[model samples]
Target: MKTKAVRLYGKSDLRLEEFELPEITDDEMLAKVVSDSLCMSSYKAALQGGDHKRVPDNVAENPVIIGHEFCGEVVKAGKNVAHLAKPGDKFTVQPAMFYKGSLEAPGYSYPFYGGDATYIIIPSEAFETDCFLKYDGEAFYHGSLAEPMSCIAGGAHVNYHTKFGSYVHEMGIKEGGKMALLAGVGPMGLGTIDYALHASRKPALLVVTDIDPVRLARAEALFTIEEAKKQGVELHYVNTAEKDEAYVMELSGGTGYDDVYVMAPVKPVVEMGDNILGMDGCLNFFAGPTNTEFKAEFNFYDVHYAATHVCSNSGGNTQDMREVLKMMGEGRLEPSVMITHVGGLNCVPEVTLKLHDIPGGKKLIYTQIDMPLTAIDDFAELGKTDAMFAELAKIVERSNGLWSAEAERYLLKNAKPIG
Candidate 1:
C-alpha cells in the first residue's frame, strides 16, 4: 500500500511525502488512519530528532513518521491477529508499547506505524503488548482523543496517600476531599477537569486556577459551575493574575487541599501546589518539561512532618486507555473540549514543526483531506466567503463553540481530498 505521511529526517527536519508501505506480515495488520491529534511531545521529537530517547539514532537515514495519538479503521487483519480484529474494525493504539523495556514507541520510533499517515502497518509489538485496542465510538476524533484523556486518567490513578500508622499506600486522589488544579486552563488541564468532575472518584470541592482570564472564562463556560453542582462538586474558577495564595486558601476554608495538581511546568506553579498541600496530601506534577534541568522547590518540612508527597506520569498504560475509551463511549466524557484547531494531512509538516508557537488546545488532522490549519474560533469569519465554513459555524455555534461528531462528519464529507 502507498501512504502519505509527515516524516522526521533530523533535528527540525520534517517532510510531507508519499511512499509505498511494505506488505503486512502474518504477525502484523494494516490500518487506514482517519484522525490524529497533535501533541507537544511530537513537537519535542521533531526538535530533538534522533536525540529524543524514543526516536532512533539512525533517524536521519531512516526517517520515522511523526504522530502517536491517532485513530483509524482496520483495512486488513493478518491471520495471527484476525481473532482480535477484522476488516472495517475501528481502532486506537496505546503508543507507549514499552516492549521489553525498550524506549521505542510508535510515532517517534517506527517508520511504518505512526499516526500522521493515510495507511500504516501495525507492528507485532503492539499486539504482543496488547496495545492494539478496538474503539467502537462513532467519531474518529473521539478515538484519537482517547490516548490524551488516558494520560489524565493515569495521573489521577497514580496519585497515592498514606495513613498515619499503616505502611499501606492508598492509590488515587482523595475522594470527597478538597482538590486544586494550578495553571489548569490548557488542553491537558481541561481534560483533567473533565475527568475530575465526571469520573467515579471525585473531589467534593474542585478549584481550577489560571493566569489567562480568556482561557479561564472559556473553561468555565464549557464546564459550568451549574453542571458541577449537579455532580455534587463545588467548582471555582480563579484568575491567579488578580488573586494570591491567600485567596486560594480562603476557598479551601483555611485548611490546605488534599490533592493539588500542578498543570504548568512553571516554578511558581509547582511551588504554589507545594504550599497548599494538607496533611497526607498528594501533589501530582502533571506537566512534562522539555528541559532536562527543570526544577521546582517543595517544602521538605511539610514532607517530613505533614506526610506530603509528589508524583508524575508521562503517559497512560493500556488499562487507563481502556477506561478513557469506555467513558467516552458511554457519553460521560467529552474529549472534544481539548480540540481548538483542525486541518488536513497536507498541513501536518508545518503544524508539527511549529506547534509551540500556535496557541490553542489540540490541533486535529484528518489524514485524507487537504486543508490549511484553521482555528474553530475563526470559522464564522471564514464562513463569510466559504459555504462549508458557514455550515460548520452554525453546527459548532449550536453546540456552544465546541467541536463535535457532526462537525467531523461534515468536514470529511465536504473537504477536498488529499492528492
Candidate 2:
C-alpha cells in the first residue's frame, strides 16, 4: 500500500511525501494509520524542518513521519512475531516503543512510529507485553490520543509542592477527594478533565477554569457541570476574568484544589504558580511551553516555604497508554467529547498558520496532503523576508493579546491562595 507521511528535512521545513510499503520485520505488527493528533511539536517541525541528530541537513535528507496518536487492526504481522496477531483484531497503539538498543531521546526521538497515515510497523514491545489494548469501537479517535494521555499519566506522578510538604502523588487516587481540573478548557486540557472525572470511582468536585468566556461556555454546554456532579463529578466553570484570587480561595472553602493541572498556554501557569495552588497543591504542567524565549517568573520563596512542588512532563509513556485505553473501554476517557473542529490532510498548514488567539478547545487533523504544510500564502511569500515576517508578526500579536486578556481573567476566578 502507498502511504503519505511528513518529513522534517531541514529547520522550519516539513513536507508530506508518498511512499511504498516496506517489508515488516520479525516480531512486529503492521497497522494502518487511522487517527493522528496535532501537537505543538508539529508546528516546530514545520518551522525547524530538519532533525539536528538524524538528518544533518536543515531539510529532510530522507522521509520521516510526524503522527504519534493512532490505533488500528493488525494488517500484517511479520513471520517471527512473538505476539499472536490475527487480522481484524482491533487495537490501540502506544506510540513509542522504548527498547534497550534504540533510543535517541536527548537530541531527537528514536524511530517511534506514529498514527498519521496509511500504515505503520510496530515493534513487539508495545503489544507483546499487552500495552496496546484491543479497540472494539466503531469510530477511531478514541484510542488515538494514547501518547498525549500517557504524558498526563506521567504528569500525575510528578513531584509538585503542597502546603504541608512535597506535592508528590501516586496514581492511587482516593475514592472521593477534592480535585480540580485547573485550566481545563482547551482541547487537550479538556481531555485531562474527562480523564480525571471518568477515571475516578466515587468522584470529586470537577472544577474547571479558563480565561476565555467562549471556551468556558462551550465546555459547560458540551458536558453539563451539574450532570457530571450527579455521576459524582462536580463541574464548576471558573472564569479567571471576574473573581480574582478571592474567588478560588472561596471555592476551596479553606483548602486549595487537590490537583491543579496547568493546561492553558504558558503565561497563565506562571501566573498560577504565583496566584493559586494553595499551601499543598499538586500542579501538573500539562501543556509544555512552545517558545523557549517566552518566560514567566514565579516565587522561589512560595515554593520552598509553602512546601509546594511543581512537576512537568513532555509526553506519555507505556503505562499511561494502558490506563487511558482501559478507561476508554469502560467509558471514562472520552476523547471524542473534546473535538471542536475536524479537517483533512489539506487543512493542516492553514490550521497551524492561523494565530490561534481565538478561544476554542482543540482542532484535530485526519490527513496531510503531499507537500510542505505552509501557513503563509503566496502573496505574503513574494514580499521581502523581513517585511513579510513583520506582517505575520502583526497577526500573532493581535491574537496573543486576546489570549492574554482571557487567561488573566481565568486565573483570578479559579486559582485561590491560602492564608
TM-score of each: 0.98, 0.74
Model 2 CA deviation exceeding 4 Å by range: 51-59, 101-112, 123-133, 157-177, 201-203, 349-359, 367-419
lDDT by residue (253-281, candidate 2, tens digit) is 66666566677556755566445655655
**Residue 237 local lDDT, model 1:** 95
TM-score result, candidate 2: 0.74
**What value does the lDDT take at residue 162 in candidate 2?**
27
**Whole-model lDDT for model 2 versus the true structure?**
0.56
Off by over 4 Å in 1: none
| Per-model CA lDDT versus the true structure | 0.94, 0.56
Worst 10 residues of 2 by lDDT: 401-410
lDDT of 2 at 392: 41
